[model samples]
Target: MRLGIIGVGHLASALVKGVLRTGFLTAENIVLAPRGHSAQLRAQFGCTIAEDNAGLVNACDTVLLAVRPQDAVAAVSGLPWRSDQIVLSACAGVSIADLAPYVQAAQVVRIMPTIAAQFGESATLVYPALPQLAPLLAALGKSYELKSEDHFEVGSVSAAIFGWAQALIGASSDWSSDKGMDRAQARALIAQTFISAGTMVAKTDEPVSQLLDSLATPGGITEAGLKHLENTAAIEAWNGAADAALGKLEKRR
Candidate 1:
């Protein structure tokens, strides 16, 4: 597949690296719009740099729309798109219907992939998922097929966790340092803990609550810690954050 990346920013760059690393596409088949950051991608991966967005679009069958949500319309609206071309949008809050007029393509799919995609570990989400797109999605990372636009928007609520997870890591690092642990060590240890937890979640079939129960044996340290967190309403605080984020997304609809 010949692919064109309209906005070669951080996320798009990661995706480019991932797809290349996974053998989803080759340097010869990929082209990117001319941007300051595009130079780095060209240097690192030898991806073709197009003279402009239109030039990139003309040369590729699949166009990845990675522009910022506010700039999406202006960026793709004037592009000379073909009816046979596929447009995959990575911009948040912009639905396929929202992008139809701008892209005017036969296929418009919305995707949400995290920065982890750069490392070939992103948990990507696709809306109005089609069977044909599975291979591309699989090459990037784990893919979830949401059946409707509403489901896709709601699925996006999980994206807020990147910031929240970083905040948590920072707080935990601070707590560890306050207890006389080395700050760098604390950071690495906590980061690894999250990674291990995520791996376990992916491998296990049991409910998360079952895992929690297994970890917190009666009268054990884990149980005590869990009780303390519960008393402080830590879980509720996380829910509140998720609710607030979901509310903002709902407002966009």
Candidate 2:
């Protein structure tokens, strides 16, 4: 497949790496835009740059918009898009309605993914206004189609956990300092814990309560910790976060 990626930043870089490993798209077949857009990814993907967006658009069958949310409009606003071109976007808050007027393609798909995609473990929530595009993006990772645009906001909020996560690592690192544990080890430990938990969720169909029950035996340390977290308003904080994101999504629309 001939693919053109607009931006080659962190997430785009991760995608190119995984795409190469998965053999869905190769360096020779993949055309890229300038590093001014996806600088880091261009360096790592080892693919030829398209010189410009139109150059890539004209050359490739499938084009992915991997640019930042703000850049998306101006980047593609003046370009001549083709009906045959399929668009898979990783931009948050930009909807299919917002995109339709700018491009010639009838197909558009929006996906929310985690940084874990670099290693091939990603939790992706898809909001495709066009049902036909679902199969096209399946190769990227686990994808889900939601009934409404409102669903994307929920995932958008979920994706924002990256910021909070880094903060958590820093906080934990500071806490571990007096114990002589360094920042690197603390970061690695949290990274492993996050991945392991994600793996468990992906593999199991059972309820999370049941999963927790399995780990939390009576009077156990895990149970004690869980109880403390629950008491400390973590659940409430998470709920507010999701609700706040949904509100923001509504306002964006």
Candidate 3:
């Protein structure tokens, strides 16, 4: 497939690296619009750089729209979109309805992928799952297909949670370092701990509560920490943060 990327920002760059690393698409088959990190990507990966958005649209069978939500419509407006082409948008809070007028006959699909795409570890979210996108999504990382646009919007909040997870990892790492642990070792350990925890949940058939209960034995360190977190209402605070993020996304719509 001839893949084109209109926005070459951080997430877009990560995706390009991921798709290439996975051998899902070669550099020769990828085309980048002439803006943002397009030149850098072309220099690094030998991908073609289009002279303009129209040229990029004309050249590729699929275009990834990664521009900011506010710029999405403007960026795609008047473009030479084809009925057979697909426009996969990663612009958060921009609905498919908002893009329909500009894209004309091209099919628009909304997507949310974290920066972890660079390492093929993104928990990408897709709305109205398209069978043709399965391989591409698999190349990026594990994908969660939403049943509807509303569910997709709710799932998109996880993109913010991804950043929050990084922040939590950093804070835990710093705490370890402050207590005299080697910074690099502490960071690696804490990050891997999170990965192990997530992997267990993903692979295990047991309910999440049961899994947690197994670890948090009475009077154990895990139980002590869980008690402290409960006393501090940490879980509630985390939920509040998610609610706020969802609110912001809804507000943008």
User: In model 3, which regions exceed 4 Å deviation?
Assistant: none
Give Cα distance to truth, residue 232, candidate 3, Å: 1.1
Which rank order by lDDT, best down to worst? 3, 1, 2
Off by over 4 Å in 1: none
Candidate 1: C-alpha lDDT: 0.85
Model 2 collision count: 1
Per-residue error for 118 in candidate 1, Å, reads 1.4
Decreasing TM-score order of the candidates: 3, 1, 2
What tens digits encode model 3's per-residue C-alpha lDDT throughout 1-253? 8999998899899999999999999999999988999889988999999989999999999999999999999999999999999999999989999999899999999999998887899999998688999999988999999998888889999999999999999999999999999999999999999999999999989999999999998999999999999999999999999999898888778
lDDT of 2 by residue, 101-206 (tens): 7876636777887766656656677776455544434555666667677767776776777667667667766777757877788778877776687679779998
Clash pairs detected, candidate 3: none
**Comparing 1 and 3 by TM-score, which wins?**
3
